[model samples]
Target: MAETSRQIPERIPVNLIVNGNRRTLDLAPWTTLLDALRDHLDLTGTKKGCDHGQCGACTVLVDGRRVNSCLTLAVMKDGAEVTTIEGLGRDGALHPLQQAFIDHDAFQCGYCTPGQICSAAGLLAEGHAKSTDDIRELMSGNLCRCGGYPNIVAAIQQAMAQS
Candidate 1:
């Protein structure tokens, strides 16, 4: 008789409420929230730039606050509400900040758009100052290699003024 090999442990079950939808995924405990969102959940709006938290491209909102998805473990976020860039708009309508970004040409390469928008959305919600210095300070974390800071800041300021 041939001996059977033992099965590996199953992935841990986690519940993540993303973009107003509840998702159940079986993922490895070591999986980061970024990977779970991009790989398993297929929410690619959250870009993985540095993956070490040095770059803010993986930024998302955890319970309406900004966070680096790559820095957070998938298991740690179980039952938590996560908001990706995909969640920022409604049916066929862009969020005010999103439209502002487009209007201001905030991005050049566009890779950082998702993170930039996500971070800006949170910053505006925080009710910070509308000065260029404050906007630059708050948005410093989300870097654009194309040197699009001026446009990015303009977009945020425009949205803030309108709001």
Candidate 2:
């Protein structure tokens, strides 16, 4: 008889600056950032749509850049700053983009709203989008099943103009 040995996964420490707060978590190396945010930190606004990188529902900002949380491991983001839907607003006030979303009616069912908003923020910060076509092209990664592309583009454009 032959005996086989199985290796056990170990929990590793990860330090993240989430929503302006430093959060230290012990997570398995395989734990995704989406799981860490939704499961461990209780930040559920960042939705899990496809669970794959194909859908941008789990999009979040890591160090001011947009990222697919489901595609990246939490351990890989150690010491990085992470921002979710919950972090966009401040002092009980909505961010300009959030307000623009509401004013433009950019969401319908709202499942993909968070990711769309986050991606828009990143796009705005990148300062490359100059027209509606540019906004649409840049925001193509974040899909809205509700077919809210028109309003989404308008909202982003309004927000960009205001900023």
Candidate 3:
């Protein structure tokens, strides 16, 4: 029995603060945060693209900042607060940014929508620069290959103006 138990790999325990909730999980050390969120906890709002951190598609907010989940190790984020696109809404109401995206037509194909939205949320929280140029510069990390940049900018600016 001891030998049989030793044959099974052990999962590393981690505490994740996700969307304002604390969760403890036993996961493989090699798992990425992306997989932990989507596969384990069922937060599917963060998209996986390129899987190499080049597409900026797996963006999520960690401790009120944006990061590429595909590049982040699950075990390394122990007790770190993580927020996905799902966290932006409240009680079935759409976040203003979400509404703005809809109003401005900020997405097509929609595969990149989650990353774009989450990145914009983090951008607004930073409050570093106000000009469109600055927004463009800060948002450079997130890419929308579907040519949704203009509308995405419009939606972000609109939400900023409202907030």
lDDT of each: 0.92, 0.95, 0.90
Question: What's the lDDT for candidate 1?
Answer: 0.92
Q: After superposition, how far is residue 45 of candidate 3 from its true place, in Å?
A: 1.5
The reply for model 3, stretches above 4 Å from the true place, is: 1-9
Worst 10 residues of 3 by lDDT: 1-10
Judge candidate 3 against the unseen true structure and give its global Cα lDDT, from 0 to 1. 0.90
- Tell how far residue 93 is off in model 1, in angstroms: 0.5
lDDT of 2 by residue, 1-163 (tens): 8999988679899999999999999999999999999999999999999998887999999999999999999999999999999999999999999999999999999999999999999999999999888998989899999999999999998899899
For TM-score, the strongest prediction is 2
**Candidate 1 residue pairs in backbone clash:** none
User: What are the runs in model 1 whose C-alpha is more than 4 Å off?
Assistant: 1-10
Tens-place lDDT digits, model 3, residues 1-163: 4554344456899899998889998998888999999999999888889999988889999998999999999899998999999898898999898999999999999888888889899999999758889888888988898999999899999999998
